[model samples]
Target: MPPSPVVPCHSPVPDPSLYEPINTLKPVVPDVWIADGPVVRMAMPCGLSMPFTTRMTIVRLRDGGLWCHSPIAPDDALFAAIDALGPVRDLVSPNQLHYAHIAAWKRRYPHAVARASPGVSERAAAQDIEARFDAAFDDAAPSPWPGEIDPLLFRGSRAFGEVVFFHRASATLVLADLIENFEKEKLTRGMRAVARLGGVLDPDGKAPLDMRMTFTDRGAARDCLRQLLAWKPQRVLLAHGRWYERDGVEQLQRAFRWLE
Candidate 1:
């Protein structure tokens, strides 16, 4: 038989709205506020109207400079708001799949370093997206988070390339779509049904999908889950769902029940 045809997986090109500047900011939780002033955190209603809330973390550097992670596209008003924070210093596309507005942000913050994800270079190139990251995550290496944060690559599995981050000072664990916890009522009708059928939702909220279907090796995934359990975080922040305030470690364990 002839060699199997190579099926190219193209990177998704986000819509124009993704780059639009933030017009308002709101606090979804105490201490954790959404900067909609020039950068809004939009709730992405995906999968049968299931609302997956995404956030853009904007920080004002000590040197009167600003930095943003998972930035949206630039708007004149949003640029002004970002300018007020300080000069743009860095733009981070934290994961390969989260590079929607990276190109626009890079254009606006020309002086800012664009930190790309591990597989971004090849994936972006395939889509003709000319963006690059200054640093990439190494599964075995330590993260350079200015001594304030640490990152660990949840390797041993090929289903998803996830690098979980830990903010030391705040004792916050940031996850990138590895887990979710939104209530079904908060989602659209279609999404609610899907969540119900998937057994990802309960009266309290939706849980993370086991996602074992995507894993190339179950053993590897199980090992990574074990490592995550060892972290013992106080608070868990998910990229696609509600944040876990207390007893985060238990919640994590419950979400990954398949590994047990």
Candidate 2:
């Protein structure tokens, strides 16, 4: 059942303390504020990379609850910071590979609804991760973020499926693993070599070759890309790399050009 629970190849968990916090008051995207919530980033060691930065987009909903997207390892200090914003209502695992920290955040906020994308539950089960997903993202926007954020299911990648979001107020497109923009300077020598081979390093971020090759149905991928283009988001945020602060729509087009 459930395709025998396909485990993601890139899933790994290290000490949360290994992460160096980069929380700031300023908006990550120019003038795109999320109430009083701050976008916190943390660098974690994994694979060939000595350390890679992951960003968590915290948005305050109309009901005074925090919606955390692609959450990173939550330490006590991070918890305090999150508490200052409001009660945590939603903890999102944007893709299969990013669910390692979902359980941790849920433990901290018992009332928070942890939502995962398609293929996450099985992968977590296969990997022995105790992730209890209260809900799963589909094509529809979640009730808490209605009209504010839109979710698009990235299809055709037999490796796994991921949900991409477009934040309307900020005109920001949020993605996990669909495209990467790692700055060469931030990667160690070994990681630089590995990233180069993976074809995910910057200038123009593109999907990894392995992932691109997994898509047997090109039509589905292209359809998702077309919908993304229609959203016209001004900024694009990637989970594992530098985000595009300007011309988000154009950047997305360039990144997914291979799908065409």
Candidate 3:
């Protein structure tokens, strides 16, 4: 009999052997004080079809409950560490492609109100991810951490639209899927080829070409970038790869170099 064709799935399907639920290799980053409060950074080994590491951010709201953004996969050690900070009251998925771990966090923090990025609910519905988005974020910042975190929604893309955030206190911009900064030495041989072809490897990493091409409204993206620049970020945090500890504004300008 002739071999049947392999149907490709554009979804988060964790390859059991390569996937690590929690970031077991590194220690949780210490908290950094932002404009209105402090935020903690956590990491995990993620990726379904391929393998890569990702990060999440946790901020304490005025009500003393934690607000988690783009949550990472959970494990016992990570859970204990998160518990030490405070009660987790809010969980968030910053982009459609970032909701894989939100369900895990929700399971652990049932009291937490989970917010999904625009179109994430639909994405979750199609995938095996058990996520119920309590609400969705738009270009405007939400009330939970109002006046401190500014959210910018980049529309006109069905591939994976993302809502970027700028934290006023620390002058730090947070992103998911929009920018990936991977060092040449860090990637596997296969990923190295992928990163090279996508033009997102090493010191000058930006969004992949596939993602950039999906952006139908560069005008909207440009305006959004302008809004973010007004914040004058000093650092940038990324979910996919290394973050910028300095020259954040310059990094943004470079990351969006294709816009102009």
Query: Which predicted model would earn the best TM-score?
Result: 2
Candidates ranked by TM-score: 2, 3, 1
Compared with the true structure, what per-residue lDDT tens digits does model 1 show for residues 1-260? 99999989795653332222234333333323234222223332342334444556554434545546666545677677666656877676666656767778777777788777667677788878767566676666655556555666665445456666665555666665566554554566666676666556643332345454456676777787776667677877655545677787787777777555
Sequence-dependent TM-score of model 2 = 0.81
TM-score of each: 0.70, 0.81, 0.79
What does candidate 3's lDDT look like per residue over 1-260, in tens digits?
98999999997765332323334323223343211111223232223134455677766655667767777766777778678778988787888877777877888888788887888888788876689767777555455577766777866565777877776766778887788876666566876777767767767788877788888887877887888888899988777656788998899898889889
lDDT of 2 by residue, 1-260 (tens): 55787777884553342223344323565323321112234332333323456667777666778778877766666777778778999888888887888888888888999998888899899989889789987666454478877878888888868888887877888887888766777666776766777778887778877788889889999998989999998888776667788998889889998888
User: Any residue pairs clashing in model 2, and if so which?
Assistant: none
Worst 10 residues of 2 by lDDT: 31-40
Q: In angstroms, how far off is 126's CA in candidate 2?
A: 0.8
What TM-score would you give candidate 3 relative to the actual structure? 0.79
Q: What's the lDDT for residue 146 in model 1?
A: 62
